[model samples]
Target: MTMTVRDLRPGVRADFEGFARVRHLALPFYLVTPDSLVYDLAHAHPASHFRPLVAEEDGEIVGTAQVGIVHDSPEPGQGYVNVYVHPERTGRGAGTALVRAAEEHLAGVGATKLFAWVLDEPGNRAFAERHGYRGSRSAHFLRLDLTNGTLPPRPPLPAGVELRTGADFADDPRPVFELDSETMSDEPSDIDYEFTDYEAWLEGTWHHPLFSPELTSIAVADGRPVAFSAARTDGGTRYGTVMTGTARAFRGRGLAKLAKADSLQRAREAGLTEAFTGNDARNGPMIAVNKWFGYEICATEVRYVRELG
Candidate 1:
């Protein structure tokens, strides 16, 4: 079987569905849909040099890669190439072909350092090592069964604080953007990011096809949002918390937990059966909060880095 690598053809229904299928087979814990795939390709910032590639065997797509530069980071030359092959299609040349295409594209865009997330498995790690990538930090993909599992009761609102939803900010979402910026800056990651562009956030996140405004929960204190849990739902029963964080001054007050709990209950009430979220392994506090909500680690991925000549 001859394996060939090529760019995903935009506006092609089969290509989008095939790409999403490969992603779902490789990473079942995260939500993947054709709409999201197309949306990302259309909305990605030009500076990011985002390119999605697919590896095909015969007439079927077997692997996918999303290669792009970290344009939002203050540091330059950092790029990422996340590759995933169909679980049953491994051992074929699909993965290697996808990686070669991804690395070549990223390097052509002036990437001096490349990063990839490999499943925390022996074979996956070996593949990265063979490709000259060194393992770095790891992350966990956690899942919660909202349909059958019991969620914590919503706690009473602390004095002077009120619970709100992202829908409340429809008229003006600057407050939500501000909260997102602050919390994102404090997130644990190898690449430091600054969310300085409000318009960019609106286009890339707030208006994304999967983002669910009604299920997202926010904590308001002293007339400003101090904590938030952003929600994203596939046009199905699957729901995910994209981000849950509290402001620096609001830490240690259990506000993050409160916000997440509210979002979970809302998701359950809205008929979302499955919930998913991811966390950096080094983020102890958030992991504890997720554990408190009965989220269990379903899968783990290790970050792999390689320096390009």
Candidate 2:
């Protein structure tokens, strides 16, 4: 059978479902839903030229690629094309085909630098190396059993600090956006990002179907958000912390830990049984915080870079 690469029809339920299925099979630690998939496709920035591609064999999706330029970055000509093939469907050229198509699109749009994440395994690393991708930073995915595991008791908030939920920002989320941008600016990564586009953030993140505002915890200081833990739920037992960080001024105060612990406790109270999150391997502080919360390293992935100019 021959495998072919083509653009994904996000409006097509089968296409979104197939992409989510492959992604879930390959990366089961994270939460993904059809609604989230559709929302991402529909609300992505027009300037980024976002394109989702899928590899098919005999009418079955075997791989997927999310190709787009990093429009929000200060640098130009930067692009990303994350490729994930069904674990059971490897060695069939689906991955290679998807990468080739993604590269062509990114290059056509003037992307001189391309990056992808490859699972840190022999075969996966070999595939990326064969395609001229060089290994870079790595990250770890952590999981916790909210139902049976013991979590730290909710710590008392320091004076002048209060814990709040995302729902509290229903009338005006701009403050939360500012806090997120401030914390995200210091996040370790190869790519530098700026969250100046509030409308885009509203569509791409705040209103995302997977986002559980009720479970998201924010630490407030003098009526301002200092740290937060963004929560995402799959409408089931699985809950994920998409981002947990503190502002630069609040780093040494342990506000991030407070926000994350509060969020996880809220997740358990909301009946979520499983919790998942990922942290860069180099982020020792965050990793330690997660460990303190009884989360264990479940899997790891490596970032790979390739130039297509």
Candidate 3:
């Protein structure tokens, strides 16, 4: 009957499990795990000021929010507060409480602009709008039934091109880091990002518990990675493509599609049953490639922005 929002207790296993559970129920298309949650809290860049919040109702977590500033962006004072309430716990006011707490933290930290992602459902959009958030860009969550669907046959590699797994770079992951940095800069997003810190990338992504180096596919040209499809699994049957892109010089050659296809195939062979990925609605090329691979639009989320006064 009573609801309260507070910061998650980092060392508490129940807190992490509850946060991950609510997130999974709210956004099943994405991978969420207790270990990943803990890693994020412990390894976030200091400037990010990351704070994970949970809404408790009678000692049970019903909603969660990941609040932080985009510290790495060239622009300052930009913050994010993504809130997700359990699917079964809607209409309980937990979401509003979490958002209010998140906004207060961001405002105190001098964030001028705050962004959140709301599922495209009418009620979800209404909730954001009622909180003074305006819808902006949108993205699609795609799903492929790897266990039941047929994947495209792996295409022959172009001359002088070779395929490799992220595992191949275990001794030296700087090449994958460079490729990720270059491709990420070109991703379509409302917030512009710069992946400048290799050490940060290693701590935040490369060594994350969910990241699957053995299943990540890379396209190598002249012995350098030009395209890649990074994979992440929930330590279960569900596998997701965290990032898949081709470098600027290799964009039109279908290298991204090739690499991702290989990654998916590898995932299937590795016993992954479900595959999930997300794409910006305006990213036509990537969307087309996903469609070519028989991915269906499972869900959509609209980015919403609210200015702090």
- Residue 124 of model 1 has an lDDT of 97
- True-structure Cα RMSD, model 1: 0.7
Show pairs that collide, candidate 2. none
**Per-residue CA lDDT of candidate 2, range 108-222, in tens?**
9989999898888999999999999999999999999999999999888899999999999989999999999888888899999998989988988899999989999999997
RMSD in Å for all candidates: 0.7, 0.9, 0.7
Give lDDT per model, in order: 0.94, 0.92, 0.94
Question: Candidate 2 or 3, higher lDDT?
Answer: 3
Give one digit per residue, the lDDT tens place, for model 1 in 120-222. 9999999999999999999999999998887889888899889999999999999999999999999888899989999899999999999999999999998
TM-score of 1: 0.99
TM-scores, all candidates, are 0.99, 0.98, 0.99
Q: Which stretches of candidate 2 lie over 4 Å from their true place?
A: none
Instruction: Tell me how far the alpha carbon of residue 73 in candidate 2 is from the true structure, in angstroms, after superposition.
Output: 0.3
> How far is 4's C-alpha from truth in model 3 (Å)?
1.1
RMSD of candidate 3 to true structure, Å: 0.7
Residue 44 lDDT in model 2? 86
